[model samples]
Target: MNWRLVFVLFAVFAVGTNALIMAGIVPAIATGLNTSEAIAGLGLTVFALTYAVVGPTLPIILSRFGRRTIMAGGLILFIGGTVLSGLAPDVSIFMLSRVIVGVAAAAIPPQAAAIAIAISPPGREGRALGLLSAGILLSIALGVPLGSLLGIWLGYSGAFLFLASLGIVGLIGLFFIPPTPKPAKATIAEQFAPFRRPAVLVLGLCAFLFAWCQYSITTFFAPLVKDSAGISDVEVPILLVIYGLTGVVAALFGGRLIDRFSGYAVAIGGFIAITITTPLFSVASSFLIAAIVVVVWSLAQNVTFPAAQVEMGRLHPANPATAFALFAALVQAGGAIGAAVSAGVLEALGPRWIAPVAAVATLIGTIVISLLARRLRRQNEAQSILVEATVDEAS
Candidate 1:
C-alpha cells in the first residue's frame, strides 16, 4: 500500500464519518434541538443537496490548485462547520452548518479517488479504490456507533464535537501527504464532456436509482430497527456496527473480485442482492432476523458502490476526475431525494413502507445495469468480429 493512500483513506474516514453519523443519532439531535425527528432528518437532506450541487463545480472552479491544497482547504472548512454545528442554538442554524460541512466534504472523496488511482501499483487499482471505499465503511463500522454512544452520553452536540476533532486529525495528516499535480484548466463544457456518452448517462442514472433506494432506509436506520424489532436506542448502534463491519468485509474483498471479474458483473450481482434483501426488512420480526438482514443488505450495498466507481473510471479513463465528481454528485442528490421522500413516507404511511419503496427502486436500478451490460457485450463482440474479418482478408 502506498503510505500516501493511507492518509487519503484517513481523510475520507473523517469526512465520511461526519456525513453518516447523523443517521445514527437523529433522535438525539431532534431532542437537543427541540425539533421533530422528521425535521432533524432534514439536516442530511440539506447537507447532501449542497454536496450534490457544489461537488462537481468545486474541482472545476479550483482546477488550478494542487489536489492536496483543495483537500486541505476542505478539511479546514469541515472543522469550522462541525464546530458551528455543535454550537447551533436551533435546527435552522444546525442545518446551515450542515450546508457548510457539505460543501467542505464535497472536496474530499473525488480527489481522494483520483489520488488513489494515480498512486496505486499497476493492476491494483481496484484494491486501491476498495481501500477508499473501506474508509467510508470503516467510518460506518466504527465512527457512527461511537458517535451514537457519545450522543447518548454527552449529547448530539458532543457527537458533533467528536467529529470535529476527527476533522482536525485529518487536516494535520493532509500536510504529510505529498502534493498531487495540478489539473489542467478546462472550460466548464470541456470538464463535463464525458456526459456526452450514452454509457456514462446510463451509469449515472443507475447510480442515482440505487442511491435513492439505499438511503431511504439508511437515513432512518436507527428508527426503522427500533420500530420493527422493539430495540432500545443503545442497541441501535450495535446493529449499525454489525451492518458496517459486514460492509467493510465486502468492500475490501469486492475490489479483488472486480479485478478478477468485471465491474459490470459485480455491480449487477450487488444490485440483485439488494433488491432481494431490502424487502426482507418488512418481515424482520426479531433483532436477530434484522441483524441477519442487515449483514446481507450492507454487503450488497457496499460492494455496489466501489464496483460502480470502478466502472466510472473505466468508462471515462481520459478524465476520471470528472466522472467521479459527477458520480458523487448524483449519488448525493439521490440520497437527498431519498431521505426527503422517506421522511414523507415515515410521516404518512410509517416506517414499514420505507423498505418496500426502497426495494422497488433497487429493482429498477438492477434492470438498468443489466441493459447496459448487454449493450457493452454486444459492442465488444462486434469489434472482435471486425478484427477477425480484417485479418482473414489480409491473409
Candidate 2:
C-alpha cells in the first residue's frame, strides 16, 4: 500500500462523509435552518443532483489538466463550500453551499481512483479499489454517526465545521500525491463512445438503480427509525454503526470475490438478494428486526459498489478514468432521484414505504442486469472468434 493511495482514499472519504451526514443529522439541520425536514432533506437532493449532472462532464473538461491540478483545486473548492455550509444562516444559503460542495466533491473521486489504479501493483487492482471503497464504508460507519453526535452536542453547524476540517486535511494530503497525466490515446469521441455499448450502458443502469435503492431509505434512515421504531437520538449512532460495520465486511469480501468471480456474477447475485431483502425492511416494526434488516441491506448494497467499478474497468480497461466517471455520475444521479422522490413519498406515504419501493426498483435492476450480462458474454465470444479468424488468416 503506497502512502499516496492512502491519501486518495482519504480524499474520497472526506467528501463521502459529508454526503452521508444528512442521513444521521437531517433533523438537526432542519431545526437549525427553521425549515421542514423534507426541505432539509432536499439539501441532499441538491448536492446529489449537482454532482450527478456536473460530475461526468467534468472529467472531459478537466482531462487536459494533471491530476495534481484537478485534485488540489477541487479540494480547495470543497473545503470552502463546507465552511460556507457551516456558516449558512438559512435553508437557501445552506442548500447553495451544498451545491458548491457537491460539484467540488464530484471531481475528486474518479481522478483519485485513476491515480490509485495507475500506481497499483499488478494483479492488485481489485485490492487497491477495495481500499478506496473501504474509505466510503468508513465514512458511513465512523464519520456520519460521529457527525450526528457532534450535532447533538455542538449544533448542526458544528457538524459542517467538522466536515470542513476533514476536507482541509485532505487538501493538505493532496500536495503529497504525485501527478498523473490524462490518457493521450483516447480521442474525445471515444471517451463518449463507450456509452453506446450495451454492456456499459447496462452496468451504468445497475449502478443507478442500486444507488436509488440505498439512498432512498438512507437519506432519511435516522428520522424514519426514530419515528417508526421509537429509537432515541442517542441510539441513532449505534444503529448506523451496525450498518457501517456490516458494510465494511461486505465491501472487503466483495472485492476479493469480484477478483475471483466476475463482477457480473457478484452484481447479479447481490442485486437479487437486494430485491428480496429490501422489502423485508418495510415489515421491520421492531428495533431488533429493523437492525437486522439494516445490516442485510447494507451488506447487499455495499458489496455491489466495488463490483460495479470493477465491471466498468473491464468495460474499458484502457480508460478506467472515463469508465469510473460515468459510473460515479450514474450513482449520484440515482441517489439524487431517490432522495428527491422519497422526499415526496415521505410526505405522502411516510418512511415505511421507502424500503418496499426500493425493492421494486432493485427487482427491475436485477432483471436488466441479468439480460445485460448475457448479452455481454455473447459479444465477447463473437469478438474472440473474430480475433482467432484474423490470426489464422495471417498465419
Candidate 3:
C-alpha cells in the first residue's frame, strides 16, 4: 500500500527481469556475436554463477552506504552493463557485461527486503514481504516470455535497449525512496554464523533442494515441451506464459499460508504436493498437461521462501538482513549448481529426465526436511524447558 514497497518492487522487477532476459536472447546473442548457442548461454550461466558467488559479499562491501544509495548504484551498474552488452562485438565482452550486471543485482534484494521488514508493522510482515516476493516471482513468470518476445521481434540490440530502459525507471523509483541506515558489517563467515542453528541449516539445505528442482524443470521445461509434444517453436512462449501466470497466483496466496500455518509445515507440505504432481509432469505430452504441471511446480516453488523466512525470523529475531543475505546467496548457488547438473543430465540422457530427476530430488529433500523439522522441534522444547526450570527455581 505504501510507496516504499512500490520502489522496492520496481528495483527487484528490473534486476530480475534483466537477469532472465538472457534466456530469451540466447540465439540472438549468438547470432550477434557470431558464436555458438551453447557458448551464448554462458552469458546466463556466468551471470548466475557470479551472482551466487557474490550475493552475500556485496552487502558487506556496501555496508557503509545508505540503502537507497546502494540500490541506485546497483541500477547504475546494470545500466552500464546493458549498454556494454548492446555494444559488445565479441562473446567475451558480452560475458563480461553479464557478470557486471550480476555483481550489481546482488546488492539490491537483501537490503531492500531488510528495509521492507524493518518498517513493517508487527503481524503485517507476512503481507509486506509477500509484496516484495510477489515482484520477484512475477518477474520470472511474466518477464521471461515478454523478454523473449522482445528479442524475437526487435533483435539483440532492441532487447537490451528495453532492459536498459527498465534499469533507468528502477533507478528513478529508487531515487525517491527513503534511505535506511546501513547495516553493520559482518564478515562472510560471521554472516553465515546464523546457520550454526540446526533449524537454520535445515532451512538452507531445503532451499538448496528447492532451487535444484526448480532450475532443473524450468531450464528445460520448454525443451521438454518441444521434444515430447512436438510443439512448434512459436507455441513454446505461449505455454511458458501459462506457467508464469500460475506463479502470480501462488505468490499472492503463499504468504498467507506461511502466516496462518507454521513455515516448517508449509515447506514439507509444499514438497509433498510437488511429489504428487511430478509424475503427471514426467508424462506430460500436451499443452494441457504441461500447463497443469508447470502451475503446480510454480505454486510449490513460490512457497519455499515465505515458509523459510518465517522460520528464519523465529530463529534469528535480531538480524534478518544478514540472515537474508546468506539465505539469498545460498539460493543462487543452488540454482547455479542445479542448472549445471541438469544440463549435464540432459546431455547424457534427455529432456524427459528433468521430471524424474526433479521427482526423486523432491522426495530426497522431503526426507531431509522431515528430519530437520524433528530436530528443530526438539531444540525448541529443550530451550523452553530450560527457561521454565529457571523461572520455577527463581520463584
Candidate 4:
C-alpha cells in the first residue's frame, strides 16, 4: 500500500467531514444561530453551490502551484473557515463561513482523485477509488456522529472547533507525503472538452440527478427522523452512527464489487437500491424501520459513488483531474439544487415528502445511466474491432 496515497485518502476524509458534518447537525446549528431550519439548510445549499462553481476553477488557477500546494492551501483555508464558523455571531456570517469552507473543500477531491488515479497500479483503479470514497463514508460514520454529539454537548460552535482540529491533523500528515511531479497543465478548452462526448455528458447528467436525490435525504435526515420517530436532538448522533457504520461497510466492500463486476452493472445495482429505498425512507414509521431503511439507503449511496468516479476516470484517462473535476462539479450542482429545493419541500410539504421526491429523481437518473452504459459498451466494441482489423491487416 502506498502510504502517500493513504495520506491523500485521509486528507479527503477530513475534507468530506468538514463539508458534510452540517447535514447531521443542521438543526443544532439553526437553534444556536437563532434561525429556522430552512435558513440553516441554506448553509448546505451555499456550501454546495460554492463547491460546484469553485471546485473546477481551483485546478486551473492553482495549476501553476501544483497539487501539493493546492492540497495544503485548501486545508489552511478550511481551518480558517472553520474558525470563522465557530466564532460567527449570526446566521449570515455562519453561512459565509460555510461558503469559504466549501470552496476550500472543493480543492481536495479533484486533487485526491487525480492522485488516486495516477498512483493506482493497473486493474486496481476501482479499488483505489473505492478507498477514496470510503474516506467520505467514514466521515459520515465517525465525523458526523461525533460532531453531532459534540454539538449536543458543547453546541455547534464546538463541533466546528473539533472539525478544525481534524484539519490540523490532516495538514500535518501532508509532510510525510513525498514530493510528487507536477502534472501537465491542461487548457481550459481541454478541461471542458470531455463534455462533448455523448457518453460523458450522459454520465454527468446521471450523476447530477442522483446527487440531487441523495442529498435531499442527507441534508434533512436528522430532522426527518425526529419528525417521524419523535427523537430528541441528542439521539440523532447515535442513529447517524448507525447510518454511517453501515455505509462504511458498504463503501469498503463496494469497491470490490466494482472491481469484480462492470461499472455499468455496479452503478445500475446502486440505482435500483436507491430507487427502492428512498421512498421507503419517507414512509418509515418507527425508528427501527427508519434505521433499517437508512442502512440500505446508505449502502446504495456509498457504492454508487466509486462506480461513477471509476467510470468518469476511465472516460478521460489523459486528464483525470479535469475529468473528475467536471464530475464533481455536476454532482455538487445537483447537491446544491437538492439542498435548496428540499428546504422548500420541508417547509411546505413536510420532511416526509423528501424521500419520495428523491425516489422520483433517482428513477429518472437510472434510465439515463442505463443508456450511458449501453453507449459505452458499443464504443468499446467498435474500438476492439478496429484493433483486430489493424492486426489482421498487418498479418
List, in order, the clash count of every candidate structure.
0, 0, 0, 0
The reply for model 3, stretches above 4 Å from the true place, is: 184-189, 226-231
Summed over model 3, clashes come to: 0
Tell me the TM-score of each prediction against the true structure: 0.87, 0.87, 0.89, 0.86
For residue 38, what is the lDDT in candidate 3?
99
CA-lDDT, candidates in order: 0.85, 0.81, 0.76, 0.81
Find the 10 residues in a row with the least total lDDT in model 3. 313-322
Q: What is the C-alpha RMSD of each candidate to the true structure, in Å?
A: 3.1, 3.1, 2.6, 3.2
Ranking of models by TM-score:
3, 1, 2, 4
Best by TM-score: 3
lDDT of 3 by residue, 1-395 (tens): 56667877877877888778777778888888999999998887788777878886676556667767777888889889988888898988899998998887787777677777666666666666677778877777767777778888888788888778877877887656666666556665665567687767777777787777777777787677777766787777777777666776776688777777777798788888877776566577777777777777778867766677666655655556556666777788777777778898789988877777777777887888888888878988999999999999999
Best by lDDT: 1
Model 2 stretches with alpha carbons more than 4 Å out:
22-42, 88-95, 152-158, 185-187, 220-236, 340-352
Relative to the true structure, candidate 1 reaches a TM of: 0.87
Q: Which ten residues in a row have the lowest lDDT in candidate 1?
A: 178-187
**Error of model 2, residue 53, in angstroms:** 1.6
Arrange candidates by lDDT, descending: 1, 2, 4, 3
lDDT of 4: 0.81
